[model samples]
Target: MSEGTAISDASASRAASSSAPLAERYAEAMIPVFGTPQRVLVRGEGCRVWDDAGRAYLDLLGGIAVNALGHGHPALVDALAKQAPQLAHVSNFFATEPQIELAETLLSLAGAPQGSGVFFANSGTEANEAAFKLARRHGGAERPRILALENSFHGRTMGALALTSKAAYREPFAPLPGGVEFIPSGDTAALEAALAPRDVAAVVAEPIQGEAGVRPLDPAYLRALREATRDTGTLLILDEVQTGIGRTGSWFAHQGVEGVVPDAMTLAKGLGGGFPIGAMIAFGPEVRGLLTAGQHGTTFGGNPLGAAVALAVLGTIREDGLLEHVRTLGESFAARVLALGDPRITEVRGAGLLRGIGLAEPIAPQVAAAALEAGFIVNAPDPSTIRIAPPLVITDQELGSFADALPALLDAAAPAAAGAAAPVDPSAAPAADDKDPS
Candidate 1:
């Protein structure tokens, strides 16, 4: 490299760190794992967040489905405010009411059978990491193989990354703990064939593969997984990191369907309504016993503060009937978007508020960029799919605003040469998955 270029780069970094801008300073201080920040958001309320520049954008992504109650909801704030003043945390040697209560509530909501158990962690990957250990323990030396699905995203930790199918995410950390295999998603035959040997330990899947363009697995396919895994004595682990915690209008997305109960399930993301908390539920005593005492532990997994907040989030969802609202709004949400008759949109995929607006062409990145410019926030999970997971508390009017602006967003994103537009009359309003569970 030239000395002049090196010196120039160093100067630029120094300037950015000094006082250039919040985003520039972020680049100077943080690693480039996420590439760049779309905006330097300072604060948020309800379904909107304000950037450092003071511009407000509708938060359609809802922090990628983590902000279940939107922002600054009194339930969450009060829960933390109250809990922090009380017993905020306790060592694992002892227990707390909030933690125990949260576990019971989650079990009841999940319809977990008698003798089920819950293990808490700080994030989804940690939960999956625990699930991975359980799977290995269940398999022991004889049944060492584990199976995951193609286009699946478990999490980012090494164990979870091993279960994740994307080559890009798993390749860099090559030689990840082995015995993990990927099969065609939604393919019943492949699932059966893979389990024929009865040598696999556990099969992990997401009801809706959120990171993989929000594609939802078929309910029938999930049922097949349950039957096959059960027949082979293999554990069925559902990764509901994105679908659980009422994001899909239910305790878990799988509950919206029927006859697809997993032997174990992973949870996080919206569980604490933006607070860091993750959980793995063992469906019955047998599976729960897989992880005996001292086999695994965490210091702050079920801290009272996070537990209290999660309880409040769950309680508010039930009290406010957000699940039914999400369900009704989700159906209408799809129809309304299609009613526009815009040729660019292919279909709305996913269950409840967890949706992906599939495009006719690979213009999702451009559309996401245009969305931000138009005072809206969405993400392109894939080149052809725009993911929108607005807070469960989001209203029809708020979503209608985005729907009303969708055409302009698409227009600005599409190639200029692709001409001729259709008239769209978006009547503002609200109305209205996958692997069967519960």
Candidate 2:
């Protein structure tokens, strides 16, 4: 063949090889846990991601609130690159500088007392698992029961799953760790009644119920909970996995509720800025020593790489003043979307960067689909709610673009009639693996 013919043939061969459908490949090689892959994302920068097909999309969900600094941030990348070769993985028996510094940093950020302690884990579920064990130890044998709020989500691990109130998520894993009770969220009376028995080990709550469509616990109710738990001597564990790390315009969501300090708080998601790290921070002397040395542990929980990345994330959030930026931008975004008056929108909820757009009808899935088609990524956490958790580093220009497109997106997703059922989506059913909190 001639040189030109050879070049053309090579190009065609490469194209043919690359043409295999990614979804088909995924189905063949991986379990159908998350249903079909929405899109084969290949690259990301700032607040944008590109699919294997080379389509660019503005990432508004931020990897379900895990991407605090946005994709491929220089600080996180630099920290990880620098630490990886130095001392990436170290056993708990050995101490690493990054781990100690990150722990101290987290405690200071949390305003924990002098006697506070921290336990590192690999994910949000593990963090909650550690906190669960702490509560168990603190409560001792006599106090066996635990109390969690209705419509709350902690994590998906068996121990954390027991604390989660969604029946659908918990029932399948049936006969979970026992002695857990679910009370109506934000009902101080119900909380009081549940703790009145004094048999409760801990009262676990999420300052904002992210999985239940971004419902925030009333500040007053949270304060009441603090008092109730204090009176009953029950540990109060706040699952800040989805709301911590400045996702809610603060170091932690519970801080918004004045005078309410949790006995223990689980941190993850934004921590490590997408590198997968989790921590259980215990405050006050009472609960600090509950988890003894041999009581709990992990292989790669506080590895140097993850610790360095977390330090970089926390440092950037402080130095860059992203917390205030998130506060201002979040309020503006919510107000602008609500002002569109699309009639289809009922309300806007949540604080800081974590937002939920409530629709008049059950059209969130359709709205999310429409948004995706429009080059935006969002989450339909429930049938009636669209969760928007863009990265804290997102610029005003990006927020403005999304705000301008909100009305059109909602219009495209409008329901057929007043009481008509939501359009059925074949893939909406539960997958082999449980769904993660949005």
Structure candidate 2, residue pairs in collision: none
Clashes per candidate, residues 3 or more apart or on different chains = 1, 0
Candidate 1 ranges beyond 4 A from true positions: 1-19, 416-438
User: Which stretches of model 2 miss by more than 4 angstroms?
Assistant: 1-19, 415-438
Per-residue accuracy of model 2 over 396-423 as CA lDDT, tens digit each: 7787777777766766566532344334
Candidate 2 CA-lDDT value:
0.87
Candidates' lDDT values, in order?
A: 0.89, 0.87
Best lDDT among the predictions, by candidate number: 1
**In angstroms, what RMSD does candidate 2 have relative to the true structure?**
8.2
lDDT of 2 at 241: 95
List, residue by residue over 1-438, the lDDT tens digit for candidate 1: 999999999988787678678887889789899999888888888888877777677889988899999999999999999999999889999999999999999999999999999999999999999999999999999899999999999888899999999999999999999999999999999999999998999999999999999999998898898889999999999999999988887889888668889999999999999999999999999999999989999999999999999999999999999999999898889889989899999999998999999999988988887777777789999999999999999988889878877887787777522443322222211121011111
